[model samples]
Structure formats: structure tokens, C-alpha cells
Target: MKAKARAHANIALIKYWGKSDENLSLPMNSSLSLTLDAFYTETEVEFTNSINEDVFFLNGVEDKNTLSKISKFLDLFRIARNMNERAIIKTINYVPTAAGLASSASGFAALAAATNKASGLDVNSRELSTFARRGSGSATRSIYGGIVEWQKGINDKTSFAVEIDDASWDIGMVVVIVNREEKKMSSREGMKSTILTSPFYKNWPEDSQKDLKEIKIAIKEKDFEKMGYITERNALKMHATMLGANPPIMYFEPKSILVMQIVHELRDKGIPCFFTMDAGPNVKILCRLSQGEMIKNRLMEDFKEYEIIVTGPGPGVEII
Candidate 1:
């Protein structure tokens, strides 16, 4: 039996808001993401001579369906590698249960990496990304150790993620978990609705591409201000797609907007910070290392009980 492992979370800079083909996880546009250290998943695969299918675990609890998903991931990986044998996968995520931080990106990324190790499959990041993408939309970004871009491949053959940079910058993510209540709509459903109903879906072609370009330049220059501006606006625009839905739903609660206000007030006090929200109310504030204290102070004033999480760039999957 071989035990292989992987690590880290990948935060989107240029988010994947829509998909041309959901089954292939083909994005409507290219997106960039940062692999972070504060959260991640680990996986191990072994070709059990006696076992028949895959197995999965979170912390220590076993889940059959979850195991099946990992099995799907392994099937893709094995096919990509043209491996002679397939195996069972066992994985665990270290993040808190359903904190909205652990995307399937980390899980599938770790799983693919582990599968490669366990089966002695040698493949490049691009191949790994394509394999991982078959498992989850976001996992492609997790193939690289730092910032990565997942190009919306017209089809599975052309679609894959590529490394953008090492992301060894001073930027940090201040996660504000609002609603402490999870959104009933999963990110996948939100994307479906946006694609089907949002009039702004028309605007994505221009706006999303603009964000991708500016973010790429910002990373090249290692400029926090430029990076923050592009990320915040891109995220806001992504959220706007929800309001354009037929029923016009919103993920933001009153508290979610309040959290953004807290962020702005902090900036007014000369704190260097900008916030971005995903499909839900939780905000991920991008800030500089030196500005982290001031940003936290302002967040404390508004959210006294809520602790602001501090995280930096995290490397991709490797041994624990």
C-alpha cells in the first residue's frame, strides 16, 4: 500500500462565474486563483488488492458518496496517466466542517496529486489540472504551488490550469464569516442560475476579461493596490449576477453589507484593505502585512466576537 499526500486552499482572484459546459467544468472565461496556507486537504491512495471501490473521510468520519466522488476523481487521473491499474482513495480535509473555505479544489487537487504518487504516475501540472478539473471546477488551480489560471478550455482536451506566479507577496486574506449561517444555495447552483437568468451574463465577456488582465499585471508588478482594486470589483460584479436572476436572489444578508462597511471604515482610517465576497456573504479582505493590524482593529469595532482570520500564500499538495 502506498500513502501519498497534498495540501492548501486556492482563493479566486478572477472567479469562475459561469460555465459553458457544466459536466466538463468548462468555465465561460479564464480565472485566476491563489493557493493559500490557512486551509487545505490531504489525500492518500492505495491499490488495495482486496478492496473494490474508493473510500473517503473527513477528519475521521467515513462517507460512501464522498468516497464515490473521489473514485470519479481517481478514474480521471488514471485515464490521464494511462495507468495500468486503478486504486482506492482515502482523503481528509483539515478545515472546519462547512466553513465555506474548503472548495472541492483542495480536495481534488490533493487527491490527484496523491493518486499520481500512489500509482507511480508521472504527469505535468497541466495534465494533473485537467484530471482534477474533471472532479471539481476549482481544483485546476490547485495543481500549481502558487497563483494559477484555469483557462476555460473549449473542451476537456484544451481546458486546464497553468501557473501564473509563486505569489510570494505581502498580501493576506482576512476572512469575515457573516451570517455564520451558510447559504442554502451552493456555488454550483448559483452559477447555474446566473448563467440561465442573469442579464449581466452579457456583461461578463467584457468585465471578466478585464479583471483577468489587470490581475495578471498586478501579480507581475506585485502591486497590492492594483491587485485589490481588480479583485474587489471583479467579485462585486460576480455577485451582481445573482441579483439579475429571474427571481432576483441575493446571498448578502444585512450583516454581509455591514461587514463591507466595516472594511471601508477601516480604509477611511488609513487602513490598507479591500474586501471581496464570493457567492455568499462571507467576505475575504485582501490587505498588506503591515496593514493587517489596522484592518483587524476596524473589524473588531464592528464584529467584536468574530475573529478575523489571517492567512498568507500556501503551497500546493505535498507530504504532510
Candidate 2:
């Protein structure tokens, strides 16, 4: 059986910083995100008895470094479905890998969808989200589009994503590519260090929960100002926890700071835009779809050498 699927990348409005259970990829706190149409991953999976072991290819090249990880994830499907045959997985990522653009989110989500169809698992979207979570925590939310939240449930069965809004309104993002290189420290590594070392991290879950609650209300009411404020504040708090780690992990590069400053200046000029960052040097500006072009133009003046993409809400993971 063979199936192909596509899942778009998401930017967390309320960040998923730490994990409660590493093996299960359970989050310490619930997170909300908006899937972006600009970047995504498409994957194809085929189950065959002819192959002795799982083989993986990414972007037309055999990827040995990520083979073990993919095989382990595939094993989950095999074990659950009582299947012994290995599979061949091929994926292509449009987003920058490991640069805080949530490439793993889309990558694993696409893989999960394709694997489910290819293996005849026939699980629903919620179940598919949990399967994706085993690959990456953020992937749990990438299974859906628009405003999605991953509930930090007590266990695997309880933790899955729910769509908060369809994002049919004037909400969108402008992504500034500060550094596209693979990050030295991964999201898993960074979160682990912060959880173990950062004193400020103790209150992060509670704080993020409060933000999630308020942001959900703001989204339901269609209050762009309130949503933007909470989104920016929540992201800043997430980064603060990382900075408070024992060895002090800082993801912000010089250009990253410059981009943030420009966003602030734009806001002061009555432009309703806010910036959020993940575990990377890049910055993403949240704005109204109508204002995306204006925001991009203003940023382009300052970031002449960088690549900027304006994106809107994308669709959920779908078999293609």
C-alpha cells in the first residue's frame, strides 16, 4: 500500500517549551499555533514485504542521519497494526530544517498521515495527531490548520490537538529568514536543558496556560489587538526561560534582534503587527492579511539581504 500526504508548517502563538515525558513527547504546557501556507512538507510511504528494513529519502537524497528516527516512528505503526513488514518513506521539506521554522512539525505530520493511509490504520485526525506527536511535540498541532491547540494531557491518549478557529479572517504572518542553517542545539535539547536548569521555568506552564486561555477567547471574539499582545508576550516568556538556563541558551542573533526592533517600531507607527520566534534566529511577524504586504515592504527596507515571505492560514494534513 502506498499513500502521499501534505502538512503545512505552523508557528506557535503560545509556545510549547518543555516536556513532561520525553519518550512520549508529551508537553509540559498546552500550546496554540497557526499553520502557515508558505512552508510545508509532503511525504509518501509504501509498505512492502520486499524490504527487510525501513528506508528513508529526503529531498531526492538518502538521509542516513534521520533514518533511525524514522524507523523508530514507523515501528509504532507496525506494532499497533500487528504488521512486520518494513516500509519505504520519502519526504520533502519546503521549510528550513531545525531552524525554528517548525519543519519537524510538518514533516512528521505528513509522514503520520501517509503512514496511516498506507498501512490501513484508518485512524481519525485526533489519533493521527498523537501518532505525529511521538515524532515531535509540535507535530501534534500541525495535524490541523488555522488556530490549533495541543492539550498537555496526562497521557498519550489525552494529549491531542483541537482546532480553535478556522482563521478565515484577516490573520496572517510574514516570515523573516534570518538564518536558514540547521541550529546547533535542537528544540528537544534546548527544552530539556531549560527544564532541568532554569529556575524561571517552574512557572512557565502556569503562565502559558493563562495565555492560552486568554488567546483562545481573543481568537473567538476576533480581537486582533488582544491576540497579538498575548502572542508576543507568550513568546518572550518562552525565550526568557531558555535564557535562564544554567548555561544560558540564547537563540537570538543580531539580525533577530534587529527584526524585533523593526516590528516594535512598526507597531508604534499604528501598524498592528507583532513578532514571535521559536528556537532559532528567524522572526515571524503576525499581522492582518491586508497589512502583510505593507509589513513585508517595511521589513524589506531594513532587511535587504534577507528573504521574507508573507503567508496566511494553511489547511490541515491531507492525503494527496
Candidate 3:
């Protein structure tokens, strides 16, 4: 059996910071995100008796570092279906690998979709989301398109993503690529450090839940300014908790702060834009579609050396 799938990367408006159950990939708080059309991953899976063990290839090259993790993830599916055959997984990522751009989200989402189809599991989207979560928590939301939310359910059965909006409106994002290098500390390491060492992390779950509720309402009302405000604030709060950690996990580089300042300056000039960051140095600007090019142009004037891409809402994971 063989299958191929594509899944787009997402930027969390309401971030997923900590995990309640690290082994199961259960989140400490619910998160909301917007799937972007610009960056994505495509994966192909083929099960064969010829292969003695699971094999993984990324970007046309054998990836030994990630093969163990991929094999463990595939085991979940094999156990579910009682299949003994190993599979070959080939994946290509359009997004940067580990620059806080949610590559893992799209990567694992595509793998989950392709594996589900190739193995003939034929599980629904909710069930598929749980499988993706075992690979990465954010991958759970990548199972849905446009605006999505991941509920921090107590268990695997209860935790999954639900679409909040189709995002067919004028909402979009401008991504500022400050650094494409793989991060020194991964999302998992950062989350564990923040949750265990940060004194400020105790309030993160409750605060993020409140922001999620408000942003959902803002999205429903089509209030762009309100949505931007909550998105920016929620991201800042997450970083603040990281800063409060014992070692102070700082993801911002010199240019990262510069990009944030530029966004704030543009907002002061009557442009309705807000900036948010993930676990790395890149910054994403939330804005209306009509103003995306204008904002991109303005940022270009200041950051001639950086790559800036504008993208709109993207689709959910699908067999391709």
C-alpha cells in the first residue's frame, strides 16, 4: 500500500506553551492558530514486506537523526492495525526545518495522513489528529485548515483539534525570516524547562485559556484589531514565562527585536498589524490581506537583507 499527503504549517495566535502529560503530548492549555499557505510538508508512505525495518528519507536524503523518532511514531499505527510490515517514509519540507516556523507541525501531520491511508486504517480526522499529536503536539491542529484550535483534553481520546473558522476573510500573515538555522533548544526542551523552572508559568494556562476565548469571539465578530491585539499579547506572555525560567530561555536575536519594533512602528502609523513569535527568532505579522503587500514593502525598506513572505490561510492535511 502507498499514499502521499500534504499538510501546511500553522502559526499559533494563542500559543501552546506547556504540556500536562509529556509522554502523551497533552497540552497544559488550549491553543488557536492560523494555517498558512506559504509553508508546508509533503510525505509519502509505502508498506512492504521487502523492508526489514522502517526507513525515513527527508528532502531526498536519508535522515538518520530523525529515523528513530519516525519509527516510534509509525509503531503506534502498526500496533493499532496489528500489522507487522515496516514502511518507507519519504518527506519533503517547504518550510525551514527548526526555525520556529512550525515545520514539525506540518511534517508530522503529513506523515500521519500518509501513514493512515497507506496502512488502510481509514480513521476519521479526529482520530488522525490524536495520532499526529503523538509525534508533535502542534501537529494535532495541522489536521484542520484555516483557523483551528487544539483543546487541552485530559487524555488522547479527548484531546484533538477543531476548526474555529474557514478563514475565508481578509486575514493573512507576513513572515520575517531572521534566521533559518536549527534552534539550539527544541520546542520540547524549552517547554520542559519553562514548565519546571519558570515561576511565572503557573499562570500561563489560565491566561492562555482566557485569550483563546476572547480571540475566538474576535474572529467570530470579524474584529481584526481585537484579534491582532490578543494574538500579540498572548505570544508575548508565553515568551515572558520563558524569560522567567531559571536559565532564561531567550529566542530573540538582535534582528528579531528589530522586526518587532518595526511592526510596532507601523501600527503607530495607523497600520493595523501585530507581531508574534514562536520558539525561535522569526517573527510573523498578523494583518489584513489588503495591507499585506504594503506591510511587506515597509518591512523590506528596513530589512533589505532578510526574506519576507506574505501568506494567507491554508488548507488542512489531505492525500495528494
Candidate 4:
């Protein structure tokens, strides 16, 4: 049997900006995301008594640190499968080796989904999502088909991500790769600093809750204007909170603003678009399905030097 599994990377609408428990990878608040077809990763897991330790080949590169990051998740899979400790996990990303795409989303999602099958656990999506959450808070959202929410489990059991919508409607993303070759800060470190030092971290509870309610309503009403604006604002505020931290850390760069302003200009031009960024220089722009082509053209007009990617709703895990 071919043990291959495929998972698509997702961009957060209400991002998981800070973590409460770094060791468990728990987040301070719930987050929602939409899986995108722009980038993805595929992985296969097989038991090999021959191998000494859990091994990982990322895009065919043998990296021990990769295995280390993935190591915490393996015990649960072994317990579920009732198997021995020895296994080899092989993963490949469809995206270029360094695209600044959220590989952890697709990477861990594929691992959880494939490991379940590899272990013969017969677990459902909820269980797999829960398992992935332990590895990374956002990983839970990646298991669902389309728009997904990672509900911050009060403990570990109750909090897990679930599918909220198919997002087959007029929704998509246009990623602006401002500096594909240069990464500013790591997401793990940025989130950690924001949690410990940022004064605004306290305000996140009230502000984010309000933002979440409004965005969900906008999505339900199919109000692209409200949804796009709210998403963009939330992303900006999340980065701003980092600046409030002691020895402040920020994800945005000079180019990030240029890209964001152009996205707003597109909205004014009647091709509604809004941008969101993670810990990298790239910005993922939210736009309607009907406006995807127009937005891409607008981006190309100004940013001939940067990569412009257009993608829409993507399915969750699938066998390849």
C-alpha cells in the first residue's frame, strides 16, 4: 500500500499570535484559518526496524533537527498504532525548498494524518487535529477541509480545531513574496517574546474576542469588505503587540508596508483585497474569487520584482 498523504498549508484569519504554554505549544487564544492551494506538503511514514531512530527526509534532505521537532508527536502515533519505536517519516513539500510558506501547517498536518493511517489507528479528523495541536497550535486548523478554527482547549482535550466551512464561496488569497530569500524573525521566537513581555498581550483577550465575533459574522454574511478589512487589521495589531514587548520584536519590514498599501489600493479600485503576514516578509492577501485575476494583475503592475501567487480553497489531507 502506498502510504503517501497530502496536506495544504493554511493562512490564519485570526492568527494564533502568542502562546501560553511553549512546551505544549498551546496558544493564548483560539484562531481560525482557511486552507490555500498555493502551497502544500506530502509525507509518508513507514516502520523500519532497520533504522536506529525516527528519521526525516525533508525534500530529500536528511535533517536531524527536523526529526527532533517532529519527535514529540511520534509517541502518540506509536501508542495509537501499538507499534514499536522504530519508524521512518518521509516528507516532501510541493513548494520550493524555501518559499516562506507556512510549512509547519502542511508539514505537521500531513504527519498527523499519515501517521494515523501508518499506525492503523482508524482515528477521525477530530482526533488527528487534536494530536496535531500538541505539536503546534495552528496545526489543528490544517486538518480540516477548508475554513477551520483551532478552539483553544482549556486543557488539552476540549480544545481542538474543527471545520467551520468549505469556503467554496468567493474567497481566496494572493501571496506577495516581498523577500522570499530573507526571513526577518522566526515565528516560534516572536510568539514567545510577545507572550512574556508585551503589555498589549493583556488586551488581546478583549480585542481578539471582539474581532473574532465580527469576522465570523462577516464570513457568514459573505461580506468580503468587512472580512478583508477585519483580517488585515487583526494582522496589523498582532504585529503591533510585538512592538509593545520589551526589546520589541516585529515581523513587518519596510517592504511589508508597501505590499499592504498596494493591497488597499486594489480594494479602492473595486477589486477588494487585504493582506495578512506571519513572521516572514511575505504577505497573503485576501480577495474574492471573482476578483482574484484582477487583483493579481494589479499586483503585477506595481511589483514586477516580487513573486505574486494566487490560490483558492484547498481540500484537507488526501492520499496521493
Residue range with the least summed lDDT across 10 consecutive positions in model 2? 94-103
Indicate whether candidate 1 or candidate 3 has the larger TM-score.
3
Listed in order, each prediction's TM-score against the native is 0.92, 0.98, 0.98, 0.94
Looking at model 1, report the run of 10 residues with the lowest lDDT sum. Answer: 94-103
Model 3 residue 300 CA deviation in Å? 0.9
Each model's total of backbone clashes: 2, 0, 0, 1
Candidate 1 residues 260-279, lDDT tens each?
88877777877768888777
Q: Of models 1 and 4, which has the larger lDDT?
A: 4
TM-score for candidate 1: 0.92
Q: Whole-model lDDT for model 4 versus the true structure?
A: 0.81
Query: In order, what lDDT does every prediction score?
Result: 0.77, 0.94, 0.94, 0.81
Question: How do the residues 1-320 of candidate 3 rate in per-residue lDDT, one tens digit apiece?
Answer: 89999999999999999999989999999999999999999999999999898889999999989999999999998999999889999999998445778999999999999999999998999889999999999999999999999998989898999999999889999999999888888989999999999999999999999999999999999998999999999999999999999899999899999989999999999999999999999999999978999999998998898889999999999999
Off by over 4 Å in 4: 97-99
Give the number of colliding residue pairs in candidate 4: 1
- Which pairs clash (backbone N, Cα, C closer than 3 Å) in model 3? none
Report the lDDT of model 4 for residue 146.
78
Clashing pairs in 4: 153-159
